[model samples]
Target: MITEKCVRDSFAEQAGYCKILGSSFMSDLLTGLGKQLDKSTETGRRVLQWSGDPAHKADALALRLAGALHALARSGQDQALAKFYHNPELSSDAEFIPAVLSAIAANDDELYQWLEFAPQTNEVARASIIYSGLSVIAKRFGLPLSLYEMGCSGGLNLQCAQFGYQFKGVEFGDNASILQLSPDWSGELPPDANVEILSRQGCDLNPLSVMDADDAAKLVAYLWPDQPLRIARVEAAIAIAKNDPPKLEKADAAAWVEDRFQADGAKGNVRVLYDTIAWNYFPDPVKDRIDQHMHEVGSAANADNPIAWLTFEFDEEDKGPFLKLRTWPGGGQAEILASADPHVNKIHWLQEN
Candidate 1:
């Protein structure tokens, strides 16, 4: 977990205005601004414009504007920022932050609705890395999976394999027909295997019902502020949901995992996995409980009835995502598969001893 001291240190590295505000001050200010911007009243604009420094004022205004767009996107308001985006004068002035807000605001739909604005606390890149790692493990385990994702905001990464992947000299998916491919990779790719996903289920603390168009827009806005691919992915997921919405449940991860594991049909040659980012959000006790349950179930697993865990998570010492692969019925320590950037689509296989 990133410590408060680390957070403070990060704030200390900021320049000029941000530096002056300090971490605590900035935290309060952001929270206050987020609340105030939702009102969309004169007071909001006045507060937004009150920063003393010119740069700070611009930053504050941008933040306020982004926050409002974020709220609109979260609430599923369709194209709420369209007018703002189309206004030629504000286009360049809005910068990347506003551009993201404007794009999301324009894409209000069921699939888009699942996207939620996560604070910086949410580690998207890490999550992507974990997904990539798990994909590799899935291949190695030679298991046909029925994936169940927790906190599956927008289900973008869920489509990782379906989407074209290109990294290093290797390539996967149908890429030549689509966009140019470029991803970072530094190890051997996972062994080729016929992998099939029988089903995909997801749970979230707050599931986006998409009953409200406004909520869909808000989801798009919550996506990373600058990744257009992410926007496209969310849009695609939305389309998928329109045809067949993912089976989603509003529930706690620990309880959900316990119940699922306890249920008779949950066992298969299926590989149960979670990756880099989501695990951190789980409280320690929840994590412990999940781990214990996995271990108990794993103890009974075998080659014919195999259960495996594939995780791509932070390697604090290496400052990158590390892949850990473990199997059950011969319960033991997990093997380190590889370590690399989590967002890179390609997987690098490490030699197992």
Candidate 2:
């Protein structure tokens, strides 16, 4: 059974993560809520009396509430609540928690409804790091890719090949594209390789469509208010996706991979399976199934139909996220290519071109 103290501790812990990710606004906001959230309001009651595991790795309870507050703010339903998002004076030590408490009371029903769903950021800039990995694969194999993404959310990154990228000094994709992801770089730059994505498909339990106005708006709202760049890039990506949306299906991660492997596609293209900060969301059983199934299918991967597993995920030991890759014919060999914060904004290249 989850204790009330445990849930409240998760709020503070998540706030620390927000701070580390360069969102002091989110950090302070979450801190204020964690310190003061009580059973006076329906939302507070539901949050405190939650039955499920509320850790970031489990239910992500803190992020759910944070996303909920952001959604309510974007709706323009509460003026006082919106001020706490970015206003320095309003978010000061004395006034911040009061503003948070007031908002929870005023928007009790909406916030409570939001807790039923998980948060989906669909961060667009992280694609730059994924593109760097793609660049390495392209240069190494000199082949087109059949990309499959797990926990795809809006499938915005599925259109990664369409977005502009700059890894260190090396550039890829259309320079004039509305969405440009140029993360801070170091070490040898990724080689300027011709990366072609022959096919793209992704799976998510609760997939959002960029073409859907409501979904699009919801995605934008989840972005931290202090980071307008994320908001702008998402808007651009959403606009681009509307022109030619990638294939996204609602399915379990394990089931989707099994189905995709069973339904063979065009030969000779490198089959890449990738995800960003999404692995922790999979339940232990689901994780095992996906891993076991991948190993089974990966055993058959050959030079002509190679398979690559790419990931951008947190490493508690490293105190930050790392970009890692494993490709069969040598599936057992794993390579860490780069390191970056959760958003992949300021990154250090780890591999030589």
Candidate 3:
């Protein structure tokens, strides 16, 4: 059951997320839209009794609405609203709110259908942090990596090794590649060792296909209107993906990890299971099962065929995202390599300068 207050709060929370991530335009837009939705007789009458896991309904609704708006804009149904997004000067102009509202009212049916699924932000820049983590692990183990990712939307990060990276005066990967991540780096540089990815695979409940035009558009829809650079990055990744889409399997996160661990590690390879900003979405039971399976596999790891769990997730005590690495055979403790923003706009390495 979705209450008016519940919907408002969800929008408010997403507003906060956008504001913190440096999108004043989206933050204000969402706040105004939420208030309008709370007071709209049309919305109340048209939007059906909300259906989904109660925990995610609010965010789901907000994302669905955003998708609807993007869909309308891309379809050129609302030139005014579309212009507001395409031009920077038009942002923060409250005059556009009425147009946005009208767009929503016209497409309430499609928006409601979108609410059935959770938002798949599909942030690929996060793979920059993952690349750093992998580089460190490779330096330690000296073996090629077999990568597995949980909640990999289009599995763009699976191809992180193919993209160029620039961090604190250091550069790696294909310098000629169109996509590159150069986050504001603070503290000491990460290991300079080259990490070889022998394979890349991931699991998503409903994976987006980078090769599909509609699927790629949905990813763009999820981006905040305020960030042009991010929009370009997604486009760059999509272009690269068109040539060779990353291997993504549709499956439950915990089930995939358990199945992967059922067999011994391949000879002379280091199996690394990694996820970024995706850990919190998993239910307790699923997380518990994945954790148990990883420990079991880590315990049996040998020097020649080792295992590592690399994560860029929130540390409860620190109340922030940290880049962490835990390995087997010799790695029993998780190491905090760096602390980062929810997006890879900024990263602070924990290593000594």
Q: What is the C-alpha lDDT of each candidate?
A: 0.50, 0.83, 0.79
Where does candidate 1 stray beyond 4 Å?
A: 1-67, 70-139, 174-182, 209-212, 224-226, 263-268, 315-319, 342-353
Q: Candidate 2, residues 19-131: lDDT per residue as tens digits?
A: 88888877887887787899998899999999999988789898888888887777778887777664633555677678778888888887898898877789888898898
Q: Pick the candidate with the highest TM-score.
A: 3
lDDT of 1 at 163: 45
What TM-score would each prediction reach against the true structure? 0.64, 0.84, 0.88
What lDDT score goes with residue 29 in model 3? 75
Q: Quick one: best lDDT, which candidate?
A: 2
Residue 146 of candidate 1: its Cα lDDT?
65
Tens-place lDDT per residue, model 1, 274-305, is 54456666788987997898888777666656
User: Cα lDDT of model 1 overall?
Assistant: 0.50
The residue-by-residue lDDT of candidate 3 on 1-353, one tens digit each, is 66656667677777777788788777777777767663353443433234442233334566666666765687676787788777745656867777787766676666556555556767878978998898888999899999999988888888888889899868977678999889999988888876998988999888998877777778888887777888888889888878877688999999999998754777798999999877887889999999988988888899998999999999767577999888898745888899888888899999652
Q: Is candidate 2 or candidate 3 better by lDDT?
A: 2
1 against 3, candidate with superior TM-score: 3
